[model samples]
Target: MSALHFDEATHTYTENGVRVPSVTQILAPLNDLSFIKPDVLQFKRDLGTAVHKATELYDLGELDESTVSPLVQPYLDGWIRLRAELPFEILGMEERVFHPAHRYAGTYDRLVLLDGKRCIFDLKTGAMFPSYGPQTAAYKNAVEKASGKRVEGRYAIELRDDCTYRLHEMTDPEDWQVFLGCLALHRFKNKHAA
Candidate 1:
């Protein structure tokens, strides 16, 4: 257990020997609609904590009721069971390096291999939104680049609200190109800052 260290000056996360740029750090210059709502921030923290705890328990082979909120417990349990019983590997648990123009670093939620097919997943502790499609597409691009192979599908595990999971195949290469363009721009900007 560690405290969340915040840089009052930069508002970034600095803990566990990792520097996590605040949401504002990545979104501030991109657009005006980058404000982090209170609810969204809370959900993000909770989701990350839940995943971390689940991972620890998995390593120890411990199976018990999840510590996450009841509404999201089902999804957590399902993931644990699936991981234990199914033949799949979660690859994105390892931190990946990203060199972008404006953004030099970022991490994906989860990249997995299931049934000999690559899968990219972004777990959400909230309701599904229309924008999730593009977000998942971005994850697909990130996973593909990091793994040097194409992903068969992108998915979002909505743990709360509707508690639904959605999967979509990446049929359009153009979408991936757009995502890469964004990463390039982010990397460029970061280099200029450096």
Candidate 2:
């Protein structure tokens, strides 16, 4: 069996001595964020990191309510509200997984049982995008292989700034194909890079 290690500082994974690209990295070709300013983008990215940490703490029952940042409180509220609306049993949170066959790695937000079916529920603080379809699908494939559980569904939940959420179920199997295509393209580019 190949060894896998996740470095928290870089949010990266190395499998059997090889550094692997993540799902987000593979999907980089789809990103068109040139419209957003650099400083604004940095702030959004920082907010996302903080919010994800808060939610992970909450899931692990380690969150100190009093210490929650005011800037991050709204997202936590939205996440909490989402739990109330659609109750789920969490199987894993912020789990780093690697797919040896594909030579890639990623961290999934939540592996859960929602509506009596095992599913991959990704949490996002930003607007729901089409790319999320394949993003969650990739997470599903890697998670199922690592955990030996058949993911029955793929969903992405957007936790809004107004404490509301939009839950989207990704039902297209082609999303997996899309992710594979992205992965292939990513590998090709990397291999031929100067």
Candidate 3:
């Protein structure tokens, strides 16, 4: 097994003691969230993060529902609703994976058997933006590379604030290429950092 470490504080990954950029980091150059005010952006980031943690804990059977904060309850409910509808068997949750060839790493939300199909997933607590496709594509690619098992599907489950979710099938063939392009640009920019 390769030594892959994810530092939660910095949202970074290190493989074999060498720093490796994450999917989001590589795609940051093209992610224009600038329209959101800084404070609103921070709040959204925090809420999304909290929801992810709560959902992971719940999936692992470690969450105390009673302790769930009211602020994140709706998002959790959205996830639960999705579970009720899809009825998936969880194979992996909050899994950290790295692509040896691309040298990028990311933590995917879940890998599941949905209707007997192997599907990799990403959970979102906000709008299902166009970027989600590439984000999930990068995750699917990394997970497939780290594990020999083939991932037959890629999805983004957007959990809204009102206890509802929309499932998006990321079937676009160009999404992975988009992420790879971002990675290349990131590398070039890093190499020429002033």
Candidate 4:
């Protein structure tokens, strides 16, 4: 595993050789006027792409195996198999939101009742870590707030050849708030930076 660290406690992030920016530094006024950013739009686009790809795979079956994503093939295959064997339906994927309280709209990967329980499964194609908890929670909060429905839990389908998954049951609201706050703070900084 890689030890890439983004000091959220300090509000710093380091990617490759670029110096990380602090939340305060980022939130600092760039000019007299404030503006919504293009990056946010791009982020929504990227999320849309991811959600679209997952849905395509789910609807059309697995893509032709490629040499690059071989390690994650089983994970996708397993999800395909699970999706096929059961009466599981893709309730909605990449549904957009226009909530006023939300910093930005969110896209949900899957909203389906599994074995009689409503669940949210996020497709993870990258590395694993505990840091993603808040982001997921924020998504849950956003979805629930937008849809006026309660989300019981959050999960990640780790797509690999081994086809393993990690299930995270949503805890109380406090921890969920922490993650949401972090995202909110980041958005504040991002807006200022723009």
Overall lDDT per candidate, in order of appearance: 0.54, 0.89, 0.89, 0.53
As a whole number from 0 to 100, the lDDT of residue 138 in candidate 4 is 59
- Put down candidate 3 lDDT per residue, 72-152, tens digits, no spaces: 999999999998888989999988899999999988899999988889889988766777888888988888787887888
> Considering summed lDDT, which 10 consecutive residues are worst modelled in model 3?
125-134
Q: Which stretches of candidate 4 lie over 4 Å from their true place?
A: 1-55, 60-72, 84-87, 168-173, 191-194
lDDT string for model 4 (88-185, tens) is 65555644332334433344577777766666776664454454455456567667876788877777655444554445555555646665566567
lDDT of 1 by residue, 1-194 (tens): 33335554654555455664433244334333347687977876677567646654654567465445665566565566545665677766524434222223334466788788877666655444444455556556545555578878776655433433334344555655555555556557877995
Model 1 spans with C-alpha error above 4 angstroms: 1-48, 59-72, 81-87, 92-94, 100-103, 130-134, 140-147, 161-172, 180-194
TM-scores for all candidates?
0.55, 0.96, 0.96, 0.57
Residue 105 deviation, candidate 4, in Å?
2.2
Better of 2 and 4 by TM-score: 2
Order of candidates by TM-score, top first? 3, 2, 4, 1
Q: Ranking under lDDT, best-scoring first?
A: 3, 2, 1, 4
**3 against 4, candidate with superior lDDT:** 3
Report how far off residue 145 is in candidate 1 (Å). Answer: 4.0
When summed lDDT is taken over every stretch of 10 residues in candidate 4, the lowest stretch is 24-33
